[model samples]
Target: MKKAIFLMVLALVFLTPQLSVHADGPDQMIIINKVNNQLYYFDDGTLIRQFPVATGKEDTPTPEGAFTLANKIKNRPWYKENIPGGAANNPLGKRWLGLKVGHNRGHMYGIHGNIRESSIGKYVTNGCIRMHNNDVYWLFNQVAVGTPVIVTRFQGNVEEFAARSGYHVMTWDGEMVDEFQIGRVETLRPMKLYSYNEKGEPIAMQWVPANTRYQVYATDGKGTYTVGSNKYLLYTTPNDTKYELVPSYIKR
Candidate 1:
């Protein structure tokens, strides 16, 4: 009986899941959405906060891949080229979260505060992700070394996860879009519209009228939606008098 009881206890221990030290921490992951220029903070699979960020420029775009936060620095000085840190002209803002990405573990790319506030929503950085000084300082305090940092071109799965978590849907310009529950249509209306290809350019000038329904499948970074099978661009009139679509959805 004693031997059998001991074996049962060993089996229970083996079957139990071991919690990772990194996963149990409040600040375990940071996801950078390059497409919409946003940074998402997740603590144990829950989103803690999000902030707008500026990524790499066209020529020297921010690296798109997974990385680990290797170091944290307060009032870090910049030393790239001849520029010095702590100077008024220094681009590195108030804090820095260094990243270790790719085979170049020694790479100097990181997430840091920026002096140019206007560059927050634009792709103007030289590889490092740039955030507002105040925002970075707040984030720097939340995370620790070895936290996972994923940089991607699009939000994709993270968007869906955040939506399900009851987070507000926001456009790149910070406009709030209506919350849409899955498997439900918000509003249906009849309207006349023209057809446009996936590129958003007009395909034909002929206007087609039909009753259409709106469902939120995916929204672009600019807060535009392509609804239904024909992929109509959902928009509103300048005066906000009525909602319009590029190509009217006509049912057969």
Candidate 2:
């Protein structure tokens, strides 16, 4: 639980200026789900606010990941397209909690207010997380930058659910590579490994946390390929390169 808290703290601390540098901000937490069309706010496990929300269409379902507040824009334009400034008729009612995930082109995903209160609790938007205009207005005023924004499957064992990822290391040049695939768990969280060198001698052993970053290198030229995170089977080149799991390089 301390590690989980540390990870959350790391997420909050690394989330950029939206939270850290803000002035006169309250320490609040946000929970949003497109699956349930609900938005929740809490302070230290005490529910402080709750509201109905609208979600993305089935075809354009909102992505599932951990994100943080990137920025806040009030009364902003809906998108480029000369789409008229956000106002009474605008879909982005009053606030946009820009997501920490990268957007293609100029696309943006936000926890924004919507003009269509009637559409609350239903799938209605392109891909943004939506809330009732009044509720968003309230959120806009309350949520501070750096507040943790978890956009995930909305339900299920969020803590247990693991992402499909894998990694392999080269001993000679000491290069590590990560491979990501869909619907695989062999490379899921809580990784454990033991590494040996060319003489079949144990060099090092370690455990890796999911979504954490790490790396390793061999000072000796004769390293060996050891075990790998589940799904991936490693093969070395003819040059006697070694591979093994290293704590350095696993990342979120």
Q: Estimate TM-scores for all models.
A: 0.53, 0.50
* Candidate 1 C-alpha lDDT tens digits along 71-184: 887767777655555566778886788887665552379898887899998999898999998899899888878776667654345533332222222321122223331211
Which pairs clash inside model 1? 78-85
Q: Write the per-residue lDDT of candidate 2 for residues 80-116, one digit (tens) a residue.
A: 5556666577778767777766553213778888777
Which parts of model 2 have CA positions greater than 4 angstroms off?
1-4, 8-27, 103-107, 154-252
**Considering every candidate listed, which one attains the maximal TM-score?**
1
Error of 2 at 155 (Å): 4.6
lDDT values for all models: 0.58, 0.50
* Separate clash counts for every candidate: 1, 15
